[model samples]
Target: MEPEQQPNNSVVVVMVPLTAQSHLNKLLQFAKIISSRGVPVYYMGSTMHNRQAKDRVHGWDPSTISNIHFHDCQLQLPQVITPHHDLYFSKMFPLHLLPILIQLREPLSSLLRSLSATARRVVVVHDSLMSFAAEEASLISNVEAYYCFHCVSVFALLYLQWEAFGKPIDQGLQGGDIIPRDLPRVSFEGCFPEDFSEYAAQNIQWSMLDVGNIYNSCYAIEGRFLDLMAQHQSDKMLWAIGPTNPVAFDSSAGVHHKCLEWLDKQPQSSVVYVSFGTTTSLSDAQIATDGLDICNDEVIKQRFIWVLRDATDGLDICNDEVIKAQLPNGFEERTKRVGMIVREWAPQLQILAHSSTGGFLSHCGWNSCMESLSMGVPIAAWPMHSDQPRNTMLVTEVLKVGLVVLKSLI
Candidate 1:
């Protein structure tokens, strides 16, 4: 691999997710695209937990092609703050980001102003939640900007961008910034209307997650007065690129099927890999936070590979210790003979695509949904947050391919 040139300018991409689930995944995909093209991509986020993951994409050998340079440019904590548990503080990045832009816009802009300023142009791609600040940074810096929506453009236009798209900048929410109203507010169902063109395909799994749910298909989903509000910017400057999460079982680069390598070496399709996705530590909004904890002890008499985290606090572990304690039971000893590999860090896509992989146990994040769909694998949807219930709605309710363990109860 060719070493990267000392970039003359940089494109700062920020993903300041109010809540860090599928939103972060979207920003990373865009960073991957820009980096794939050899642009200098500096991704930023509000919290360190999210930022640490942002730090890892640069060294990704997934495709055996490393073209992106990752850097952390935005920090939003430990200052001017309204404290809350996993909730998002929107003002942290922008109110503070403007100050940083003053320092960065000049020299960096001068260097990347030209297409061939001895380096790739500095572009800013932010998650929709934080794109307004990125937009401000781009205006002063004279660089390009884009927003990454890992799911469909629907939620990107509505849910994440609700404040920017729905409410005027000056108007405070009905509740303070921390408490997002429980009712569905912003709507974009009409803007990104459903296109069921893929329904004809034989492998219906790729179409597992619906655009309707991803973007909130309700008619009330879009902002009311969009035409006038929309013209604030030119179509050429702003972009909605990538719903680009490419994966394959046959190896070429980005991600290939080597699940078999691990599963093949191990045992049967008995092992189960679980990852609700990064943003699910907080209680899921749509699904009841109750009953979303670990499964009950009845093992179905099978060996397993469970990919879980220490999410007891969020799952209400103290109140739900019975469920937790039952996890390592008489079945584990007997099941251990069947073999069990438990981990918090598993190559999930690889695990799901394995030949011996009997099935998947997922929280139904769109990316993970698509991964399983691309592999035509079935799952046990344990949806955990905002659109996850909706995304899971598409998975189990619409597709009829997967099963929800406790749907009647949740």
Candidate 2:
């Protein structure tokens, strides 16, 4: 069971995140941590994705760091497939990038080999969706590969494994289904997107077989699940190295000073900061109804900031006119004195860290959840899709730090 000898001098960590903002952010945060410790990192992605990564790094003051490199695999995707719709791209892009990644492995390895001579090793850390491709490429190039679960709890991983490999937990278990008996109770129903159950099942199977796994979580919060994972899956190495907020590493000046300035004006722990991550979009109907309810409520109206991102694949709500048309008539004018509606991107980490920020109205995405918890801000979990429901459960039911806002209320 001796470890294989690597070439000397340089250590290279290749990060291949699914072409999603959240996924990329997590991997980049991990890469920064690795690079800060003296290892060189090669962040691999499609040409467009690499460009975006470069821009993001530049925004974060890249000149301060020298070891993290953006390696474009030169994947030319079709015009029909845009980066904004990362959910679709996550499933499809790998088919196109896999062969290209496989081909680039040798050149990547050779380039790393040329760097130095004392324990030179190239480790491929990839998003869960890209694990299959990364595993094949790592095998071909004789490099180490690890699956990075950028979002989701350790319990989510365990659930996926159980669903995929273990006997079907009674189909009739309904919303009250408790899983794994030992772990904290989480609703089995609506925990995952029903449409992609099969896809998730397959990924979980492969992820279990992979060399190891990385999570954007830490033992401080999810130690029980981590411990359970270790007890059961002793053969696999699970690293809980996160709460990986980019603000910890990036010193991007003036990114959101205005937001902070406004926050400073508010009473401490009085404002409720609201955001639904990057991907989830509120339907026009939901916005007209539920959106107005929250905005117009006397209690919530006085101290709220809602970040409303455009529906990437569907509507162009980024246009002020479009946003106006979608919102309930006079909603903005009604709440203008008390609330702020951010149309596009907002500097989330800064806002969450602010003293004036009392609570979070979040989609319960793992990143959002972690950021909120890290800042000691409570939450009103309103999950829209994917692993969010499960994360909501962790926040509300297990952690006792948050409450779930039922979709019926939203």
Candidate 3:
């Protein structure tokens, strides 16, 4: 390692996001926001993720966005052989991440030393899931680490702490079970698995104990919960500088432009844009009963553009046979003139920002929630799993900017 380079009046922020699209989107947006203010950002991720990040940055002018840099830290791991692929990847991620961080320390220190004397501080910002690795690496590298909660709310973080340290709550409580006063409006049945909760609580506790925290929410939306957390954990620094929608870095490609053009043709405030974020998948039965039934409605069918992304299973949802089989008989032909069904990823932010977009039908993921709100579009929340149900409450009850739809209805 090199001698400590202590400069003044400049900041070099190192950001490490979990190798997932939603997580990367939030972190990259934050990186852009900070870099725009003259700070330099060193974004670390895998080769593929770095490529995606670079592509997102390509939309911005190089002269204005020149401070953001990408670093590839690809991991070497054996082929996974598990049915629970996401779980397997999550478990294996830190093993790969730690080694990369170890290798990065000396070079990062050298880069800091090479900077002008005004470059004073080096802060490492990491996803909450990588708390363990980041905490350890920051200690070794002598950089300040801040954990970014990219997905869940600050209230969820407090609930995790309460679950871990406070009086033990029943893990198998039903949906209507009353939550303790200290916790947020969350249902036990809607919570994640017990094992997942345990893991999250452990890591979140580590983050709270060892590092500062960053939340991807603004004070207007979650100020009460943020205040509660700050009061409870007075020793640490917590910042809520978000609703971090990367509107400035959105791609202006032909495909995206085509989507905008289609929206432009529609009447203002007439279209309802529907998407379930990136990870959630609709079952065949759910697709037939829920999707078809909703589109079959006379009013909605005319002004809806549903984005049915088949990302989880890699299924070809765009195929005619696949669409016909999944939807009700003669459904597509009947709604051909009225509605549009996009079988892959759509430009969600762009669509939301369009004048014709009246509302959003979303799975209540934090990123989707932020994007919808940022665009001033109302939400029709249909939460599925993880922290979504709580997010739905935030949207419908707290913010009063959206409605909650029962899962059975959609």
Give each model's clash number: 13, 7, 0
Off by over 4 Å in 3: 1-10, 54-64, 76-120, 145-150, 167-186, 246-255, 297-300, 313-325, 328-330, 408-410
* TM-score quality measure for candidate 2: 0.78
Q: Which candidate model has the greater lDDT, 1 or 2?
A: 2
Best by TM-score: 2
Q: After superposition, how far is residue 99 of candidate 3 from its true place, in Å?
A: 13
Alpha carbon lDDT of each predicted model: 0.41, 0.62, 0.62
RMSD after Cα superposition, model 1: 12.6
Q: Estimate each model's TM-score.
A: 0.54, 0.78, 0.76
Candidate 2 lDDT, 1-410, residue by residue in tens = 11223346555676767665667677777778888898777776655665555444313644468877776665444333323322432332123333333454444444334432344456767787655544344444335455555467775666655555554533213333334443444445554444455554555555664677788888889887777667656787778988776534243463655666778788889888888765565666666666667666554555788887643322122223333225666776877766778865577777887788999998887878888898899999887766676777678777889997755222
Give the per-residue lDDT of model 1 (tens digit) for 49-163: 3444443332144234354443333333323222232342121112322333234333333323332333434444433333343434344434444342334423322333444
RMSD values for the candidates in order, in angstroms, are: 12.6, 6.5, 6.7
Which rank order by TM-score, best down to worst? 2, 3, 1
Model 1 misplaced regions, further than 4 Å: 1-26, 45-51, 54-67, 73-121, 148-243, 249-262, 265-271, 279-299, 312-331, 339-341, 408-410
Of the pair 1 and 2, which is ahead by TM-score? 2
**Poorest 10 consecutive residues of model 2 by lDDT?**
312-321
